[model samples]
Target: MRPFSLRVFVPSGDPTGVLIATRDDGIGKATIFSRSLLGEVKGRKEWNLPGIYLLVGPSKLYIGEGDPVGKRLEDHAAKKAFWERALYFTAETRLNKAHIQHLESKLVKLAQEAGVVPLDNGNTPQAPALGEEEYAFVENVLADLLLMLPLLGYPQFEASEVAAASSDEEVDAPHAAATGKRRAAYSAMPRGLLFHSTSKDARATIETVDGGVLLKAGSIVASEPAPSFDVWMPKYAQMRRQLIESGVIDAQDGRLVVKQDQFFSSASGAATVVRGVSSNADGWIGADGQNLGDLLRQWKQKNFC
Candidate 1:
């Protein structure tokens, strides 16, 4: 991977709230915010520009394009409860309606091919006709978007190798954001930490990400929980039940398979879900061969020091 820098700016002085991701080249920018913060970002000039958007939640994903994305987001906000995060892309250059339509179409196709999440859109629309030059330009915008999105805690549409990429957005106009290194090392290990979990009946892989830990797609999960699993991790116990009910985890041939990447608040929780029993450090092996508890301790020490 070529070396690049990504910036994430949090408005409202809250990193967990509305934020923006952008690159130094000023080619494009992304605005990310929860559904609750939609009103806060509705006033930005970029919202009125031609752009493509993805509305994502725990259960479904919707991809669309609008000449001015703000209106569509507002419409979805009123009609859709499944999406918690609304992320959209608009370029610094003049992108017309056709450009965004092409982006929307391509994004829909890719997400469908990925087959990781159920879609809210009933049908994918055909891309608008574009000249060779316009197509090339829009593709560049899409490439930048795919690279930066995963770092903002969204890895849904991207491929495994590309999902490891990071972004460029600002939560507020005329404000700057934090920078991240896009290097070979980052590609090799997307978030700098990896963990493996295995048991007699299941095996899985996980990585520490910006907000939490990610259980990789295609990981084998235990088909059944331990007798005392609820007592061990009450929160994840309920979550696991919901996941199964929602078809996020499907049972096939006595194995429970995760269909897409899932993020957890901690490594312990992810490990518990994977192995179907109480787990912490002992349940997962970290990149350096240290248990999660040991790795967590070292991280705490290093940061505090």
Candidate 2:
């Protein structure tokens, strides 16, 4: 890939002004995001809203967006995966921390070299004006950068995976490769016993033992109280069904075995709640609310989006 390009908009208020980089990209893929009034400018007629596109060949691809000559090329290595795999390339700045500083620095230099002036007053600026030559230069850099992302393992799944598979006979749905599993690792569960309580402490604490969730509020209470686990609710229908299919519990058995309840709630929870399973971790709903929070945070940290 070539260097990434940077684009800035000068804010309306100032001129001796400030230049705020709105979007930066390696070709079609950009990290900095921005919107333009030109899209709504009255009677401009020929100006079109910017969009990304790819021109594909037997063994190569050409990717780009907007006028290439006008943009400033910066770092392209950081944006490879998004252009190739993501349906749209928009990520929280934190998600690209490793490369943000480097790219940001390069943009400042490029903007100044191009005689682009900052809006001033320390506020964000509007996009700088680009001559026909400059705009085309930036466009080329962006397109080249976009072309490089595919080489970095950004699009691992082939076109066949992207296309919907046709079938005469119904089969299991294809899942994302993140889990590397054929079908959902867990099945739906049936409604069963429930226990609810609230903790008064500042920090939330939870533990799972004997197939039951243990919630601890703080030192506020002398001992952790156990809630009733006998009542079944409709929400658990899917969980119950999964347990029955897994052979972990026999529905007709009048006796409520603790082992059966444990199996149904954990290993055999509903597939809807089981985000996925891996070789070591069995993904399922957490027994305690805190556990659920932890699971969600982990998903976010991994940048599942």
Candidate 3:
């Protein structure tokens, strides 16, 4: 990966209200400000240029573009109640109304596919026409914006696990080596963990991976959460519900089965959602035939000692 530099300024002593600029020439700049700081930043010169912007809230996202970007933000502040912060992207010279419209169209599509946050935009604009050079330039700008957005606490544009897994790029040698070790260890193990739903005929295989756990496709989950499901954190419950609602998992043969591979932040999180009960990460067995806790201890000794 190519290294890039970012310069961020906090104007109001509040880190949430920021101005982000890149070292790369021709790439655009971004300003991320809270709705409360609109009065302080609305008159800035960048807002007068044609740009694409995002309105982000706790659970929802909206993407748009306009010339004289200040006016568009003002209108959204008056009408859109969910968003608490806005991020605007504008170029010094290359960007124009057509370029911004194209960016808006592409961003909306990406956010929807990411499914990291729900979109509030009712309509998606069609991408505008541009020459090959201009299109490539805009793509570079968008790439920078995507990298910066997540660091700024706006993750709506982050790629989904499936998308990341299906990327065409070859894995780095070190990562490929580690993955090979994991697969070999798993193959030699007697068995993986099996989590069973308390309220239904559902079960799933649990496997450890780098940084987290994987719930393999075709693994089963309860069709509905059990009455005692409150044993798990609300966020885990919500995640399970979202998976069902999104049709990522569906009921068949009296149980819900995952349609695609899924990742969780921890073994316990994956287990809790699969079993609809409280779970302990240490209880999960690893490929070495040791529990997760013991495996982690061995790994730490080898890598960190």
Kindly report which residue stretches of model 1 are placed more than 4 angstroms away from their true locations once superposed. 160-305
lDDT of 3 by residue, 1-305 (tens): 36766677665676656565554542777888888888888768887888889998988989999897888999999999999888898886878888888788778877876678889999867878776567656666776677777776788766554311101111121366555543443344344454322334556766555445578888888664543242214456667877877888887776799988787645556766776655544545544556654554455456545
Cα-based RMSD of candidate 3: 11.7
Query: Whole-model lDDT, candidate 3?
Result: 0.67
Between the candidate structures 2 and 3, which one is better when assessed by TM-score? 3
Each model's TM-score, in the order given?
Answer: 0.52, 0.17, 0.53
- What does candidate 2's lDDT look like per residue over 1-305, in tens digits? 33554554444444323222333543333322112221222122112223332322233332333322112111222323222211122122221222222222223333332332331113222324444444344434433433443443223112222212112011122345422221212111122423222232111223333332333222111121111000111123333334444644332334211123232222212221111111011222345533232333344355433
Task: Residues 171-258, candidate 1: write the lDDT tens digits.
Answer: 1112221212111112323474777888888899887676456888889998867533443344566678778768888887778998
* Alpha carbon lDDT of each predicted model: 0.71, 0.27, 0.67
Best by TM-score: 3
Angstrom error at residue 252, model 2: 44
Off by over 4 Å in 3: 13-18, 23-26, 162-305
Model 2's alpha-carbon lDDT is 0.27
Residue 296's lDDT within candidate 1 is 54
User: Residue 207 of model 1: what lDDT?
Assistant: 77
